[model samples]
Target: MNDVTTDHADPRTVRLLVALYPARYRAAHGEDICATFAEATAGRPRSAVLRECRDLATHALRLRLRIGPTDPAGRVLAGAAPVALALAAGCAGYFLLPQLRELVHRIRYPYPGLGLGHAVLDATLQTAYTVPWLLALGIAALGRWRSARIAGGAAALLSVGVLALTGLYPYTAGQMATMALVGALVLLAPAGLVDVTRRGRWEMVGLALAVALPMIAVDRYGAQHLLLPVLALLPIWLSAVAAPALLGRLSGGRPDRLRAAGVGLGALPWLMPLAAVAAFDRPARLHTLLQYAGACVAPLGAAVAVAGAVHLARRVRTTDPADPA
Candidate 1:
């Protein structure tokens, strides 16, 4: 009789493969699977070990989504933080920095003009500033939580330093604070709280596009015209209201009243710009419109954030089993 011993299979490798399963599944059957694999493949070909490892990974992913559930609040925060942080970085680098540089040059040179050198430098700086956040997002998508946290933290710190050094703090303190909050959420959230699944990646992409497309359109088509900027930003305002509701529905969790209310309140930031535009006569230039819009949105964003915190607290209280009934 031919023996099927797995002498060729490394025990350490077998254990590592078993660890790929979900936490619950590993706790339940990890040791048994490891032992069985070690015994059954004692003299088997290396191909058998590879096949088993592949199967383990597939099953692990399926079980992660099916059995090992995650908190909806955590999932939403985790999914949203990266997109918000990336947007913050991109805006600071691509939109704010060049303008600040031009202002400095105007003061120093007494005249300023767009030149090939300046354009190249601007593009280079923009790319440099944007790359770290992109890398962090990519790492987060792969479920490399630790790496993502490190990358995000580094990027946030870099942004803070740049803003402080350039004397742009007065203009961007609110944005910096928002970036800090997003960084903290990414770095401090518990393991498995952030779902790095394919669905999670798509959600991030959708949110990013929701924010980005309008900004791009405004910059390209509306920045030089009055009323056009307002029109372009209208989609962003609409998205702010729609995104949370859509995300909540797709999260696959039971609907909670507080969460819904929080999401509704969170949309207030987008509404504030529209309200400001309505209250005042149309601005003469694009910059004035943007300035007023930003001023209106920042305070409202804070209020909505507070509401979101209250919602999170309520969710925690409801989910906690040890609390007194």
Candidate 2:
């Protein structure tokens, strides 16, 4: 077997890979790990060398987290605020732009048959659609946690009132339950802006309801068309729920708990439509099945990606600073 010495190994490549670790970590153990790699990969195939590099990278991350300055909870908290803000921005854009366009249309093309009061009511509803997200985005961006909390709370109450009046007034058991869950999620989300606690997690049961009760209500009502409004507002509902959980997780809450929240919340927007369809009790078409299947799967995929990103962020933030690069 050829004994490849440190000089014989590719220093540049090894250094490049080592750079993936935290600067302080690399400063402390980079040369030693590289030497170990050179010795281990002597007379090995290219696949073996690649495998060793992967292992090294994994070890580096483990060490970085283990020896880093911030604790797990602290790292999570710090990262969560930004995540919340981003989610708020995305939701605002998704739900707001369409309303803005409609508002413009209303201005340009007034309805001839509509009464003045009705027209004013229509305009008020349109404004309601856009205002909560705008408030959330602004307050969250400004780091005004208290104001954001108030905005979220107000939005939740307003959403319930609107839904009850227009969508499900004289509410059935299922609708009542669904709205309760939405309210809980909205109320608890602000907690994520600072930190997540055991109590906050208990409150997140709303997430489960957010996913399940909508379908149950649709089935009970035998109204397939009801799925449209539910699905349309789902992104906003999810953003409201997820922003806080992400904030809590990034701030220092348990990742497992946060990941579970993410999975449940993420699954709802896409899966609710399918669940509504299933409630229809009709024959399933192949194309429809495929479409719903994709919808159901997309959120799960996104949940996994989000979980991985959170983990990576945790590791990156926890690096030791004493060691020089």
Candidate 3:
């Protein structure tokens, strides 16, 4: 283990040499790296701190992907929003974006007046618009009626309409309905939350029905029309099921009470827009996701980064006042 010491060595060169971590991480580690650099430099400058930090950050990313998650604390420390957004974008871009392009070609190339950019923009907008509508319909079905006679009836009707209009029977609307249904049951905490438990079981049934209707409709309607929506809903359904369980473990309640509470609280922010989408059948897709990313994720990421930055900034803050002539 080598020790570090502070001594002159063309401080600018020393500072310039440590600039290789991601800007945010680099800024945090520069001083410490620089101090180590000073020791290694001895009476002369060393030139590889920048390269070293880059390797370190890259290695860190690899380690994260390999290590099974321990708790939400580990995630919180790593920055959850960026990680989730990156993963979502990766999955969507890989799967959905190309199909969306084909849909764009079908709509725009039909007419000659539009520019290439306009066609792309139009497709993006349409896909984006549909997300909210699906979300809205789901919430309305889940929230408005609780009985099999009422809730299932309403979900069935809406499920059919969404399937017809979107050309997929259940779609994201059904997925949202499923999430709401699960969340509602969790709220009930059946057993102790007996009524809620029963309702949750029903909700699961509703979600399954919502999901099922589209598959049946697709078989009836054919694959080209049905496939895209199936792609979209699969992620949401899986996420809805898995997220709560993962969140519960992260929240640290053996019976999952705290996990349920945290999820309920976290979910409240999206409720209004999500509910509105369900009620109105408006598509808020990419826009809603973007809004969540911007309003929710970005700010949180910034706040964490800023806090870290400020901590560094305080250390770097000048201790001496201006010197008199």
Candidate 2 per-residue lDDT over residues 1-325, each given as its tens digit: 3443223447787887788788887888878878888898776766677778866765565455542213443333333332333333344345455466666676567688775566667767756644674575456445555566567556546645655566532223233334334333333342434433444333333343343344335434645555555544454345444544444443453554544453344324333334444444366554665565555455445545666777788778787465666
- Can you give the TM-score per candidate against the true fold? 0.46, 0.42, 0.28
TM accuracy, model 3: 0.28
Would you list the C-alpha lDDT of every candidate in the order shown?
Answer: 0.54, 0.51, 0.39
Q: Is candidate 1 or candidate 3 better by lDDT?
A: 1
How do these models rank on lDDT, best leading? 1, 2, 3
Predicted structure 2, TM vs. truth: 0.42
lDDT of 1: 0.54
Rank candidates, TM-score, best first: 1, 2, 3
**Candidate 3, residues 1-325: lDDT per residue as tens digits?**
1223323455666555454344665567767777775665554323344444444443344334332134332233222211121122222233333466577665656456666766666565544434332333343335332232233233334433443455423334544454344333222221121222444334333433444444445544665655345443344432343243234333332334333333333323223334444445556565764453344333233433444555466556766566899
Clashing pairs in 2: 73-252, 76-250, 76-251, 77-250, 77-251, 77-252
Report the C-alpha lDDT of model 1 over 1-325, residue by residue, as the tens digit. 2344346567677767777777887999987887777676666766776777765664565456542225454445444444454444334333443366664564455535755566555545554455677677667667676688788877767655554544543235544554565565555443455545787566555544555566656666667775545544543454453455434543434544433333333333333334444445445654765665664455335545555666677788888899476
For candidate 2, give the lDDT of residue 8.
Answer: 42
**What does candidate 1 score in Cα RMSD to the true structure?**
13.8
